[model samples]
Target: MAIDPKELRRCLGHFTTGVTVITCQGEDGTPHGATVNAFTAVSLEPPLVLVSLDRRSRLCGLLEARAFTVNVLESAQKDLALHFAGRPNQEVRWAADSACGAPRLDGTLAHISCTPWQAYDGGDHVLYVGEVQQFHIHEGRPLLFHSGQFHHLGGDHNPLLWDDSADGPDAGVSFISTLAGTRRV
Candidate 1:
């Protein structure tokens, strides 16, 4: 039996995700974007990321084998997200120049530019994987989404698990070592 679409969406909504605007240049060389939450870091070896866009979205067609920027939104950029999601905010800002051939949005938490790596059919969505070309990060908390609402990071314990350190659970060996001490193996 087919699952109810609303039920599926409600179940998926439990998974919190970072908000982003996937931007690409149109055929006319103008910037176009869509607010996307289905973004993932696919690989680190070649530095790949993936964004799933609905097959009907114009941004999906514009991204065919082209460069794009995944601008992770800051906590304060909910209006920008709404704008790209089709609400039309006239005062939306743009960066001075393009990054990796795609227009960059201003005041984002992070900007990751990429060239098209591959595309795959994802039912009603198309998963576009991109090879990392350039990226920038600013010191700020990310915008988040969950359960059909915009959210933000909370004061959780030890939220920053990894950092610029040479140590601290960096490998499987360290995890095994920690477990070995508590087990009689």
Candidate 2:
């Protein structure tokens, strides 16, 4: 069967993922980044992560040469995500990650410093697997992406399904159902 690119993209959109702005400083000493959702935790023993980037991205070469930082934005940071994802002509401001010299946004839920470990050619994109050298997690709900939009994670107003009915015996079932149907975003 012939695969339609548009259809493929739309189908992939169904899988919700957290949003992150992958940042790095170029050889020219300029900060560069792009909004990315293709991120995942690869290992926990030594701490590792994987982020895929389109080969044609301006930051690709810089990311290959130097260390990089992944700033996981909080729900309130939707503007930052949109900024980094903006056109190349737009301006962006970034600060340095002290441990690795990677660029990081001012405020984020978490910041991870990593050294490029492996780069594999993956069709139109390059898979960048990194070894995490250091990381910091702050208290805040994460910014999520689903169906091509940003979403806030938490609030007192949103009650847990199981907690909703104290007298209900189907709490466990309700919890599982909620988990299965709820997208991260």
Candidate 3:
């Protein structure tokens, strides 16, 4: 016999994911969005991303062979995430992306504008892959969700805090040291 669906869902919930609001316009150009945590980067060379949408969602139908924007939510914008998830909150901010004409929500940590590339059947969800047209990564921590709860970054170590790291910018392996000024590795 097949495993219990609830058990499978609980197992999947162990995988942490960043929150996103995938936005696209209707035939009449009306903006529409839905909170989607099932999103991931598919490729880097051509810059592609994939987002899974429920088969019955309205936005899912509109995205067929259409352009869209994926707004990776910041931790402070959790209410906006709830709004897109069908709980309509008080504050909703959106602006049109100049490159793709897709709606990108403000206060998001990052945004990716894309053109429809391909679609795959995913049992109960449609996996839509898009070719990235433009993207922006602003300064903010991304909103995260895991085990049905909202979460924030847990690590204290930031990789880019130093102006010059040995393996990063400096040639001949040089680094900016706090004690001695410049150290060569």
Candidate 4:
């Protein structure tokens, strides 16, 4: 049976995600950005991240593989997100260079500077993987998207710590086991 696109979309909407603005210098030498939620860290060792963009998006055309920045939006920047997502709002407030010379927005949670590493075909979307060059992080809660609406994070944090020799959860250690037994520093 053929799957309906709307049904697929609704199913995928169950996953909560962080909002981001993928910014890059346009061919005209001006900064251009697109609001996207399809952004995630691809690797940690080489510092890689991936952003998926619609093939027909104007921002996709404006984007150059190398030299782009991912601005993780804060909850306060919902207007900015809507602006870049095709609803022009009031003037954007861009922050000056702190980590790299990429155009960044004020009130963002973090800025990730990247150079293109690879691109892959993703049907209607193109997955662009980038090597993180530099980054700046501000202390704040990130803007979140879920079920076609915005959400905020609840105050819950993991208090677990692992030793250097520990291999994380796959190392056969459970959270309850750690609390019940002596933990390695």
Worst 10 residues of 1 by lDDT: 175-184
Q: How displaced is residue 40 in candidate 2, in Å?
A: 0.5
Worst 10-residue lDDT window, candidate 4: 173-182
**Error in Å for residue 87 of model 4:** 0.7
Steric clash count of candidate 3: 0
Q: What's the ranking of the predictions by lDDT, best on top?
A: 1, 3, 4, 2
lDDT of 2 by residue, 124-180 (tens): 999998889888899988898888778776566454344344336654543322534
Question: Highest TM-score: which candidate?
Answer: 1
Write the candidate numbers in order of decreasing TM-score: 1, 4, 3, 2
Task: Give lDDT per model, in order.
Answer: 0.88, 0.80, 0.87, 0.82
User: What are the runs in model 4 whose C-alpha is more than 4 Å off?
Assistant: 97-101, 154-185
Scored against the true structure, residue 46 in model 3 reaches a CA lDDT of: 88
lDDT of 4 by residue, 45-142 (tens): 89999999999998777664657789999978888899999999879887774354557777789989888798899999988888888888999888
- Candidate 1, residues 1-185: lDDT per residue as tens digits? 99999999999999999999999989998999999999999998799999999999999999999899999999999989999999997686889655578888999999999999999999999999999999999998989999999988766723423322333455333211232242211
Clashes of 4: 0
List candidate 2 stretches off by more than 4 Å: 87-93, 154-185
Structure candidate 2, residue pairs in collision: none
1 against 3, candidate with superior lDDT = 1
Candidate 1 residues lying further than 4 Å off, grouped into runs, are 155-160, 163-185
